[model samples]
Target: MTETKTIQKTFWQKYSTLMISLVVLVIYGWALTGLTFSGIQESAGEVSSSIFHGLTHPDWAYVYDGSGEDLVSLILQTLAIAFLGTVISAVLSVPFAFWAARGKNEGKLHPRSTTGKFMLVLIRTFPEIVLAIMFIKAVGPGSFAGVLAVSIHSIGMLGKLFSEALENMDHGADEAIYAAGGTATDVLTLATIPTIMPEFLSYTLYRFEIAVRSASILGMVGAGGIGTPLLFAIQTRSWDRVGIILLGIIIMVTAIDWLSGMLRKKLV
Candidate 1:
């Protein structure tokens, strides 16, 4: 009986608050939404009937019908923009990351000093969508605008990643190189870069995947890609075309995922 009471107490202690909170939240949600179990039942019935009447199979033949050429071109353009943007970002971030990781010194101006930190913070504060909009206005609409937008945003992101990687690196090799009369450049090339190379590559690949999706959406703002077609489909209420476009996006992302996974596996 003592053991039974202990078990009961433990069970209540674990679940009593959860059970009470669930009941309270349900009551409050129902009050807010003006919905009860009966109302949900009625709504579910109506939705079921509507779905049965409206649902239709896709026209798979339409996928192969002449749209393939246009789709392929748009996809290639998106890839090119993503690739170029990622390359530019990676290249620029390297020096920025190195500088940003350098801590404050008494006599020297450090890269991670107040001014540098503030600048990085400011750059990172703006959303990528906002940057994309600004670039669209500044450069006019095209893939170039999209590429620039991605590149700008990537600088902030890659800089942060690189700085973190630098901070976490084993400094023994760098110290040893310095002790052996190596210059700062030699120490960075021989010690720091080798240690952080894997991390840099991984981050770049991940950003490339993100850039691909961003480039596609930039087309919505007249930046050129599959998003233009997607927008058209939406405006015309072409569900079939929308479905096909979504499938294409899924395929492209999956390919990138598979390729990146393989590369990361080899890299790590």
Candidate 2:
């Protein structure tokens, strides 16, 4: 009876993986059946040629001539928007993080955390483009609208990141403080804040890199950035201008990513 039972368990184990694999394959097949493919356009070749010609002969004049609509100026403005948005979002994420990652909920279900987690999901799910349009309508189109959109959109991601950091944090210092009859303020200043600040800073720096890219895109909708001029160039069929703007954005984003990486390493 023992040998029979052992053989039966082994047989199930051997087939379970195959069964799961078959199910996954079926799901993928079903999903793929719903996809629709579009054919290439007749003007695709001409459009591609124009784009390549522009890239090969980028408008060097657009870099800077103090027109204020130049690539350099617009790129700088985009960076500023990203920086402001990142800082504001980092600050706002703190309370959300703490609320979602409460120590008391460890190893157990907590409705407060569930609700907070759901709220974060909702925040994240709200599209940044939509937020930008709303802000533009509310405060008129400009860099300020972009800043608000980026900051608010960033909260969901940053809050989730910060909460994970908090959950993984070393609670030993917190306990040590409590055992020594330390005040809550003492625990916060001595243990809680210090224990998590570095990680928080690191995450903020990482998020800043994403913010920079987002800021550039937000400008497309008149939130103000390099995107404004880029869109204008596209609409006007001035492909060279678009090429220069794209180059500038690439250089700026690459530089910021490198700098953010260095800062994150230091903080970590």
- What are the lDDT figures for the candidates, one per model? 0.78, 0.91
Clashing pairs in 1: none
Best of the candidates, TM-score? 2
Ten-residue region with minimum lDDT total, candidate 1: 51-60
Task: Please report the TM-score between candidate 1 and the true structure.
Answer: 0.74
CA RMSD of each candidate after superposition: 7.1, 2.3
Error of 2 at 142 (Å): 1.0
- Candidate 2 Cα misplacement greater than 4 A, ranges: 1-25, 35-38, 104-107
lDDT of 2 by residue, 1-268 (tens): 9999999999989999998999999999999999997988999999999989998789999899998988889999999999999999999999999877757445546776777788889999978889999999999999999999999999999999998898888889988999999989999899989999999999999999999999999988999988898888999988888888889989999999999898898899
